[model samples]
Target: MNISVNSLNMPLLECFGSETRVRMIELLSRQPMNIKELADALQLSSAIITKHIQKLEENGIVGTESISGTRGRRKVCYLIPDSIVLQLKAPEPPEEHGGSGYAVSIPVGQYERCSVKPTCGLASENGVIGMVDDPRYFSDPEHVKAKHLWFASGFIEYRIPNYLVGRQTVTSFSLSLELCSEAPGYNEHWPSDITFSLGDTVLGTWTCPGDFGSTPGVHTPKWWKLGTQHGLLKTVTVDERGTYLDGVRLSGLTSADLAIGPGRELLFRIACPDTAEHPGGVSLFGRHFGNYDQEIEVRIGYE
Candidate 1:
């Protein structure tokens, strides 16, 4: 998460001021803990720890969920974000497509084609789309309602809706989505090489650092419990220069290579090849599923 240095963010900035809070962060980093456990570990009263946990929750560093226990309901605390990025200043803007561009939000389950392996499944906010780990479920009619999906290997392809009119030259296009490596439950160290492509043009491969379940995603549903919670938001863009992943150059493939013309359909693919050195797998979180509440966003610029 990126937080800029500004007066408006003083409260969040001050989250690190107290040593107690720092210790709280440290303990929670190891694993989720309840009020009594944290209090006992810190040698403080449960009431005191509750106050600290409240502060952490207010600052968005910690999250608390009420669960049943032998005695009664207990509040369990979990870290929120795997990492934080402090931005003293704004970053350089990515190369824009053109003066005029349109953005589209495509659902994660709206894939036009897919080839997947086990440890694969898709779920809507309401429930699982079909039987988990069954490839045939990917073809289920209900798959389009999925808000989250993962696969051990193979690829999912989507058709980007082209809004270009006659003679409107395609200048650039970009796709933004939340992604992470796929693990059985959760693993902070698991890595996967995920590739992005536009039709036949291989945009590039990005190494997902982990399956990331260290904390609950900001927008993840509490009732939905498995292991994986969120992922890093990645944006792949193809412009005049080349293809870029989150503003970092990923390959030499340019917009021309995408062959995005006026009438031609745009097929974008996210893949985790079984041949990759780190064949950890791939997981995608869509709106109401990941840290960032968003769908597979597409921005198409035309002149």
Candidate 2:
């Protein structure tokens, strides 16, 4: 069967293609300013500024509002949109596109009941399972604070979309996820057997059993300790050749043999089965970390 695919697309910026408008955007990014202020900063005539501003406003890039002063007067100023994310309007798919879809399932809530018992440290705002020698903060509602400890018998499940799977002739498929060890203070020595599954088939496994060393986590609460070793595990690439951590590849793998996108939506699942004597757990960082959990994005950019 032949499968057709298209590239990802995002909104187009009307002013983005124009050099004058682009310069105005750069200056406005620094701070909000009125038309006169923008004209003065750009050293452009008011007429020119007004023309560009009109276009920008029409394109939803600039906004204007009135500010009232203590005196019986008000002022009008313009500002750039608070946020701007560029994307393709209709990205074209790979020239050679044919295959099945990919799937992923994660059991995130299951770990809530699991527990870990060790002499190690723990950090939390609600209660203490281990011990957090540092201060704890949960000031932001968007924050996700966890003080969890567990042994070799738990896992989180995630499900990928079936549409992502591609052709049988595909050489390699990458499965990326955000990961880091769960530790307090500092732990550069923690490793665990992390397993991956495609439906019921064991695609492969990796040992995450060790402290991630001392890397800062964005979502990790501010009041908590800093410089705690945490590996921002991402961009994991896998194929018939072998599995990989980030970009570094490993042996014992087969991409051609696995029916990733041949039709039956391929589902990939990760787990830390209790069977492994040495197990490591991971803490997922999300928005509160000043990063996006969904940021651990996956896309089959294939050949």
Candidate 3:
């Protein structure tokens, strides 16, 4: 159940306060039992067990029914909710890192626009979105739910949200993702020169060594026919100095070259153009399809 505070249902939260209460709930989960039975299992007095039962019943975590016994009618208690899930609030970002910044996760299937060649396809966590190697399927309405996507050539683009206001200015922009070369099945020797761009300005290109499939990805769906399994995690950062790929200098282009500002549109693109020297292909992995279990992560540092 959603542990939302807005519901004002504090009993459920309060019921788990005691170790004895939690143990009682565990016992009830196995099978319904009377107050005497619970006391015998927990080595607690009948009075204490009854008090715990009352708290659990008041919190809607348990239910009780009266049944005819040999001597007289006895109260049988059972668990109400089979399970409880606590959906706590997300933690706030720490106050550091050059005044903090904005960060977002872009799913593999939620691209704003794409143009890809054969050896292309998209899949959700459960199944493929459409026919593989058919670029037409990239525009399918269900593409938004894709957990894995791959292509032989062309590009896919997304617009990163820019939340800066007033005098706030960008210090640096970064994108991290799990990616590898795309092949028919899998080949560790394949290489691809994948390019990253911001709007029309080219950020840099990184050469992926291969399409990894030697072993199964940690989170790959079992339904797949065991093709490309995972990709290497790559991070690209652009600042006043220059562009860096995985912390190494990549290109001379700096932040000014990308024209980043307070209200600028952050059009980010991942491309495997046919003109590259190592145009093997491109395979992108999302949370449910890769070893890293993360989508395209974007972080912008600003003051």
**Strongest candidate by TM-score:** 1
lDDT of 3 by residue, 118-157 (tens): 8889989999888988999999999999999999999999
Q: State, as a TM-score between 0 and 1, how close model 1 is to the true structure.
A: 0.71
Cα distance off (Å), candidate 2, residue 207: 2.4
List where candidate 3 sits over 4 angstroms from the true fold. Answer: 1-100
The models' CA-based lDDT, in order, is 0.82, 0.47, 0.80
The digit string of per-residue lDDT tens for model 1 on 89-148 reads: 853343333446777789999999999998999989888888988999999999999999
TM-scores of all predicted structures:
0.71, 0.44, 0.67
> Cα deviation of 121 in candidate 1 (Å)?
0.8
Off by over 4 Å in 1: 1-99
Write the number of the candidate with greater lDDT, choosing between 1 and 2. Answer: 1
**Highest-scoring model, lDDT:** 1
Candidate ranking (lDDT, best to worst): 1, 3, 2
Candidate 2 error regions (>4 Å):
1-152, 164-171, 183-186, 212-215, 223-229, 240-242, 290-294, 301-303
On a 0 to 100 scale, what is the lDDT of residue 73 in model 2?
Answer: 42
Clashing pairs in 3: none
User: Where does the lowest 10-residue lDDT sum fall in candidate 3?
Assistant: 1-10
- lDDT per residue for candidate 2 within 27-105, as digits (tens), equals 8777767667778888988789878876665433454444665654432334423343332243233333343323232
